[model samples]
Target: MLNIRLASSMVSGVAGELLAAEAQTHHLRSTCSTSVSTLSSLESELESLLSKTHAIDGVTNQISSLALDTRILSLNATIEAAHAGEAGAGFAVVANAVRDLSRETAKATSTIFDHLQAVLSAVDRVQKVHEQLREQMLELDRESGVLAVRVKEQGEIVSTAVRFVDEAIDAATTPCAQAQNAPPASDTYALAPADDDYALAPADDDYGLAPVGDDYGLAPVDDDYGLAPVDEDDPYALASDEADEPPDSESMDDPYALEAV
Candidate 1:
């Protein structure tokens, strides 16, 4: 039977340790999943970016070469038309017009190509930046979530500890209050506000409170044992009857017994 009890205790301890370790592992896995997803997305984006960049370079170069060739051909045609005699005179103007048109078109194409390349470069840079920012955002969000979970867990643990401390304190103080040997928790409890205008009575004898004499000029006390306002003429004070008294009980019966009759 002893061995069984020991085995059960060991098993419970091991199970608790395993459960804690598993929770830690689960949290780690959650972080890893976010990281892995980010990395995967980044890798795929980079691959697409590399392919697009290669294609853009090749297409831009080819278009540039084509424009250059067209300009050269237009120039040669004008030269040939100029070398011919009067019979080619009419053709010469046409050829010159063709050359001018070619130059204009080539300039337009080159300008367009430059602007297009610039736009493409800008887009690529922006996309790369966006991808990086997205990865960072994902990482931050995941981290924040993990931190929030940890904070919540800590708060719960702290709340549980406080509750346990309160219960234990209440249990330890039970005996004291029962035998009237010490002040009760109720004494420590804040006095409730009276619904009526009448003053609230102090704790009574049943609550282990002492009897008040005529000098019981009740004063307001706070949780920190600080005094608030009070009426000096008020008949209620906290004086007890156990203190020194005169020989005859009837002599002290008057509310103003101590005062000159």
Candidate 2:
């Protein structure tokens, strides 16, 4: 019985019980540390994804702004075209409106394109991270790799598109100096020649106005604004007094009177 009692005391001793409890506590602490580390890593990945989403949103806003500017340019083009008239001659004369609108639109587009290029570059780098992390996720295998590849290629494509747009803006900005501010042309189609010592003679005693200058055939003009002839006593006297007067409707084409022949 004393041996049995001694054996029980040894088994239930403070040293052994305490040692076992301490080992269990250490194990729990290790497990908790691993859990904390995993959670921190997951939090970091989530933050990266959030940052990427925000970047995409910013780029989308930029694109939307560019589109709005382009729409304004389009409307301006249509409005200016409607007003250009026959005098515009060709597209060159009207090119100012087009060039101005295009330039403003190009400015907006270039800004968007530049920002987009930056975004694509950043995304490209992040895409690498997205791939490597995705591979280590311990989830789906083939789908994750394929998705990563597609995302990376899409970023590259977006970069190319942005570069193309920027180039287009630069090309459109080329200016022509002479086209915008050219002087109006000299008149080519002047009417009649000039004369000296021409006098406008008096008409009837009652009417002071006389038609004078050539055989446009005059009459005793009575009204302030000219009407036409009444019954004339003689056509010869009318012709002499008609000098300086515009040709009448009847003889307007007579080359001899105009000295054209």
Candidate 3:
């Protein structure tokens, strides 16, 4: 029983470790799954971001094209003003202002285009990184699934071992349990019932004679050596008597009478 108990303890210990490992593996798998989902969401959001960046880049290009068109229009107006000589003088001032405005617009558009390009480049880099992370998440999810399977298998094995150990312990202790619970066998060494006389000897007061008292054959006392007998009518026959007259003090004076009383 002791050996079986020890073995069961060891099996229970192993089972506990396996259960803990199983729980840890399950938690890790859940983490992997959540990470994978997050990565997928990030990928979709990154695509949307890239799309918006591309749209902004296209808008910047359109702005730059519009600025170029304005520059061309301003150049044409300046040429027309030059052709008009003195009439062209005030118009030339207007044409110069339009040309300067167009130049500034073009410079601003170029700056916007450079910023948009940088933004698009950043979006592309982010998309690439997101793809890599998504792949890693998928791999980790797969590995976690495998680990969960292995952990489940190990847990089952440990559980089966624990069950077997328990059964074995039960089997090992069965005889002892039965022996403890079984009625004791008729004792071969115990003395058998003796003769009727032997059994009746103790009831007959074998140790000594029966106690002697009034209930036995003892005779009642009738005399106190030489003293007079107490009268049944004596007032002081008992102190509890209601009669007030006391017995003769001379009769009580006898020591033998006092002894009898």
Candidate 4:
């Protein structure tokens, strides 16, 4: 019984520990799932930013094409001014300014395009890194989920063990409890009857032998030592006043009483 009780306690403790571990495992699984989701969102945003950055390439290319067209138009204007000679000098100066402006615009567009390319590259790297991290988080989440399931199963087993131990403890101690609460042997003896038809002797008063004024039936000792006188009121007395009387005259006539007189 003691061993059973101890086992019950140990099993209960194990169940408690298992429950705590199961809760922790579930929490870890949830955390991993959330992290995976956040990483996925971040990766998606990075991808979107990378696509937008690439889209800017088309705008940069159009600006570069417009700058080249402007330079070509400025060259045509300079040629026309040359055909006009001294009368087109101011026009040639304007054309020269326009050509320089177009050159500067093209340089600026090239610089912007290079910066956009660098941004796109950086975004792509970030997206790839996030994707990898998301995959790792997904793996961690799956493992955590499996661990949580195992922990939960173990907890259930421990709980079952604890319940079984408790039932065993109860079964082990039930008889003992009844024994402790039971009546004593002496009480059983008191309630039982004697084996034979026997009974206890009555008290002295029940035998008609009670002392009267401290003198039982015994008389005082004297000379001749005669029989003790009986109490006339006693129901068991054998002597009476008639035994001391002489025979009547009628009895003298009878042969048996006269003895052949």
Candidate 5:
């Protein structure tokens, strides 16, 4: 019984540990799932940014074209101002200022193009990195899910083992409990109901003799033998009955009784 109890305790402890492990695995799976989702979202945002960057690249090209058109218009104005001579000196000064402004605009637009290209390149690299991270996170999520399932399976196995141990403990302890609670063998037998035949039988050793006034199919007793007489038709009873017969009358008178007479 003690051994069974010890086994039960051990099984229960193992089952508890299995359950705890299952819970931890479940938590890890959840974390992995969430991380996968977050990475996926980040990848999607990166994709959106990449798309917007492409659109910005188109806009930047249009700005560069506008700067080239402005520079051309400034050059045409400067040529017209040179044709006007001294009367267009003030106009020539304004034209030179406009041409300088156009040149600066062109330089600024070129710088912006270079920076935008770098940004686009960086965005592409970032998108690729994000894709790799997303893939890794997804893989981790799947592995964690499998691990959680295995842990749960182990928990179930532990539960089954615990149940088996509990049943064994019950089986082992039941007999002892019954033995402790039940009556002793002697008392149990003594308290058993008596047979009706034995209960009705006479206490004395009357053999098969019927009472003097009774006629309940029982045989009558012989006066000398004090037992029922043997039946003539019963072959088995004749020899035993003769052997058990009382002695003759002469044998009944003792030597002491003859002396007295």
Candidate 6:
């Protein structure tokens, strides 16, 4: 019984530990879910940023097209200025300056486009990383959920085992407990007759033999067997008519007579 109780206690303790572990696993699952959600949101924001960055590529291309048109217009002005020599020297110089400005604008636009592409690439990589991280978090959450469930099952099993052990201990001890609390044989069941059920024999009535006195109704030994009465004062006196009296033949033949040696 002691061993059973110890086993029950151990099982209960294990159940409690398992319950704690289950709770922790649930908490971890929740944490993982939350992290996954955060990562998903971050990934979405990165996607949006990437989309906006790609939109900027269109604007940069428009700028580059405008710069190319400006350079072509500047070349046409320079050719017309050359056709009107000396009279359009200043216009040619201005045209050259305009072309140089357009070329510088185009270079700046290309540099901006390059930087934008790099930014987009970085954002894309970060988004992909977040996607992978989110997937991992989801997997972790699932695993934690599975762990929690198994722990709960194990805890229930342990609890059941503990209950069975407790019941076994109860079953084992019930008879002993009842015996300890039970009434004794003398109280529960009678082995001897009760006072009310039994009566003592009356002094006046003999069960089968004659009543006491008068030598229990026997004839006097002196008269019947020629023996004297026993001395009432001496407990060990032998019966005789006289100390030296010889027995008669009938007394010698009597079986009740005692002859002196």
C-alpha lDDT of candidate 2 relative to the true structure: 0.51
Whole-model lDDT per candidate: 0.57, 0.51, 0.72, 0.73, 0.69, 0.78
lDDT per residue for candidate 5 within 105-179, as digits (tens), equals 778878888988998899889888888887887788788788878878888988898899888878877998999
Prediction-by-prediction clash tally: 6, 8, 0, 0, 0, 0
Query: How well does candidate 6 score on lDDT at residue 160?
Result: 88
What clash pairs does model 4 have? none
Measured on C-alpha atoms, candidate 4 has an lDDT of 0.73
The C-alpha stretches of model 2 lying farther than 4 A from their native spots are 2-20, 85-261
Stretches > 4 Å off in candidate 4: 187-261
For candidate 6, the per-residue lDDT at 228 reads 38
Best by lDDT: 6
| lDDT per residue as tens, model 1, 108-218 | 667766776776677677667867876676677677567656655665665565555556656766876787874545643344333323435443322222233223434
Residue-level lDDT tens digits of model 4 in 139-162: 888888888888889889988888
TM-score of 3: 0.68
Per-model C-alpha RMSD = 25.8, 54.8, 18.9, 12.1, 9.6, 8.9
Find the 10 residues in a row with the least total lDDT in model 1.
223-232
Our tally of clashes for model 4 stands at: 0
Q: Return the number of clashes found in candidate 5.
A: 0
In the range 89-185, model 3's lDDT, one tens digit per residue, is: 8888888888888888889988988887888788889888888888887888788789888888988998898899888878878988999999978
Lowest lDDT 10-mer window, candidate 2?
A: 201-210
Which of the two, 3 or 6, has more lDDT?
A: 6
Whole-model lDDT, model 3? 0.72
Task: Write the residue-wise lDDT of candidate 2 on 1-261 in tens digits.
Answer: 355445445534533554455455555545545555665576577667657756765765676576567557656656665677654346444555555665666676667667766766776676676556545543333444455455555555555655555555445444434546677764433332323233232322222222344345354544333432221333223333334444465553433333212
